[model samples]
Target: MIKSLDIVSDLGEGFGSYQIADDDSLLQIVSSANIACGFHAGDPRTMASTVQKCIANNVAIGAHPSFPDRVGFGRRGMDLSALEVETDMLYQIGALNGFAQAFGTKLQHVTPHGKLGNYVVEDSKYANAVAEAIAKFDDSLIIVTLPGELAEAAKKKGLRIAYTIFADRAYNTDGSLVSRNQPGAVLHDIDLITSRVLRMVNEGKVTSITGQDITVKGSSLLLHGDTAGSVQMATKIRDSLIANGIIIKSLNATK
Candidate 1:
């Protein structure tokens, strides 16, 4: 079970000033916002606008980088190496950091987009390389990853880690996320998502698809803004956590 409650949102492609319907609502609720860094989604304009909001709310901003597959939306896996993943992540973070500096905010962390995130969690070499990239780019930058393998690997590389659990997403029996290709991967039931987060925050465990409770930590939680009830779900999560006396804060602030 996790010891704290922190919520993050994946802002997707509506970067800069672009508002693709109800985007700003979740910004106020989540403690962090994972803004797209071009390859998967988002543009310079959208990135700039989202940064301003994050600054205003004191929410931490992270680079949600992915393989250069805008057409696949960065969800599908690609043939990428340790070196390739590191460079790609660096490029995206550097781009956003450039705009964030203009708004007087620093890029606080980096989380791999889609398949790359899952990849590094299981592959030690890939994980270390990503961590090395982050350290080389700026050791001060935090890395948000899963609690078990991914978080451990990042920590081994001497990079700051923000252990995270997905709020609106479910994990398989083995702790990997339920693949999107599978029918119940993305949660539409607001009740289910909010309940899962509450369990993670209070119990420090997650009930995998096999109905087995596995120990987990919840340093940071995510709400995929691209998911259908994400805005409403994130709002309810914030309210519920506060109702339970949990503090809603960005990973950096709490750490």
Candidate 2:
């Protein structure tokens, strides 16, 4: 059978007058989108417009919920109770779902944003909270994340899981992503990124920052639209994957 991959990107990360990536261009390249939901970088108008665009481009929409940190772009960590995390996530998901409903589509998945994403990988409490929120909102929604506590919690809750690998980020020896604060954490070279993606999909492995080869599921590949030259890199990676006979699919169609 031919192998399939899901290409996703974070979009709608704009507030009032400030915009972050060329979402329109990136939408054409990605099969799915993790749209920022107010907390990190989106507003009511932006969310509605993004949902419409996703429908227009036939891209699956997923919620990219984050801590209430617009200034830090959800990259900074916040300490909160389990209840707070669960409620916050539910609020964000509900807000985005409203837009999706208005646009005649629904959320295909939920992926934590920035620090919360990292936390879910390391903290079971946060993982459980997130999973509970997703389960309560809609058990059918897929949880897009790396292999970790979140995945485990989602499995326990009977929610579908989509293991994702970052196309523009570096990995650690333990299969976790390297911290963005570290040097070389985010990749920029087009050839190198594409090659890494190919190896991860074809070989189920990626070279870590420590020069060690690590195993990965790579069910989905995430591309950050805000990164420099991200559009070009995404286009090249998609073309290369197709050239090699790998099918590009949406997360909803992966399973």
Candidate 3:
């Protein structure tokens, strides 16, 4: 049984006046914040502000890099070369790291956002590109990803890996996330979400969409901040974990 774990959320996804979620409230609950870098759904102001909030809440900061697909919110796949992937990852990480340094902290981890995130899991080239970027930028940075190519690449680069499990997403039998376009891909039931988290932490098992029981030993639990009622769901999951004698901490602390 897992005694401790990190709870992370994708935050700072709003651009200008177009806000997505209640980030301030989320900071109070999550142990880590994956702040977006301009490419997907954030700007300079948002990154800085989110980093400041994370510092205040004692939450770890992580870069959430994505393809240059603001219109698609980084969910749609792009046909970029390996060099493009590497450079984009570096650019995004550097931007967030600057803000993190200014805020009296450094980035603790990196998690690819949206389609890029999915691609890296299966595509060796994308995975290696991302790993190369992180290793060049900061080899000490932990890579938050599922168990796949990205994880292997991080290991090869001698970087730390934090296997993450999604609290609100459905998984396929092959351990990939169900497409958002599919029905029931994103879960909204608080009771169900909390229960799944509990089982994942304590039992290292989750029932996939295909009704197959899959093993998942995750060091962190990912919660999406932009989903409806997400704050409440996060709060409930946090409380449930604590009440069950599971410790909630930042990824850095866990490491």
Candidate 4:
């Protein structure tokens, strides 16, 4: 039986005046926060403020890095050399580290954002580059990724892994996330999502888009703040998980 799980959400994903989620409300609900590091969707001000919130609330903070694409929201894949990917990871992680240090708190983990995140599962070069970069920068920084090349590369690099699943996203039969372009790729119904998460939490499995059962490990569950009713969904999910006997603990706190 699963004793504990981390409830994490993407925070600080806004740039300038454009905001995405209710960071304040979600901060109160989530155990860990994957904050954007200014590449995909956050600016310096946003990152600093988000880190402060995490520190004030005692929520674990993780750096969320992505390709240097702002228009596509880092959802568009970029063709870059392994060195470029590694350096980009280092840059983003370092940027977040500065604010964390100023706030007297260190980042607990690193998770790639958007397309950079999805490619890490199938692209070994990309996955290894990201893993190597994080390990080089700070081996203590946990890597939150699915059970695939990313996790494997991080393991080989002697970094801790926090396997996660998308509570609001669908999965493919091959254990990859269903593309956002696909129909039903993102779930919206609150009751449905809550029930699906409960099963994934307790059974360590989820039904894929092709109607196949795929094994999933959820040391952390990823919730999206950009989605409709996300705050409500997160609150309900956290409450439901506890009601079902699962403890909501950050990955940094769990063994």
| Model 2 per-residue lDDT tens digits across residues 1-255 | 798888999999999878979999999998999999999999999999999999999899999999999999999999999999999999999999999998789899999999999999999999999999999999999999999999999998889999999898999999999999999999999999999999999999999999999999867899999899999999999999999998888977744
Please provide, for model 4 over 1-255, each residue's C-alpha lDDT reduced to its tens digit, 9 standing for 90 to 100.
658989999999998888989999999999999999988899999999999999888899999999999899899999999999999999999999999999899999999999999999889999999999998899988999988899999888788998888899999988888899999999999998999999998888899989999888868999999999999999999999999898898987845
lDDT by residue for model 1 over 92-151, one digit each (tens)? 889999989898889888988888787778877667777877888898888888755667
* Model 2 lDDT at residue 147: 94
Q: How do the candidates rank by TM-score, highest first?
A: 2, 3, 4, 1
Cα lDDT of model 3 by residue, 38-132, tens digit: 99899999999999999989999999999999999999999899999999999999999999988789999999999999999999999999999
TM-scores, one per candidate:
0.92, 0.98, 0.98, 0.98
Distance (Å) between predicted and true CA of 188, model 1?
1.5
Q: List the residue pairs that clash in candidate 3.
A: none
Per-model tally of clashing residue pairs: 10, 0, 0, 0
165 Cα displacement, candidate 3 (Å) = 0.3
Q: Look at candidate 4 and tell me the lDDT of residue 63.
A: 94
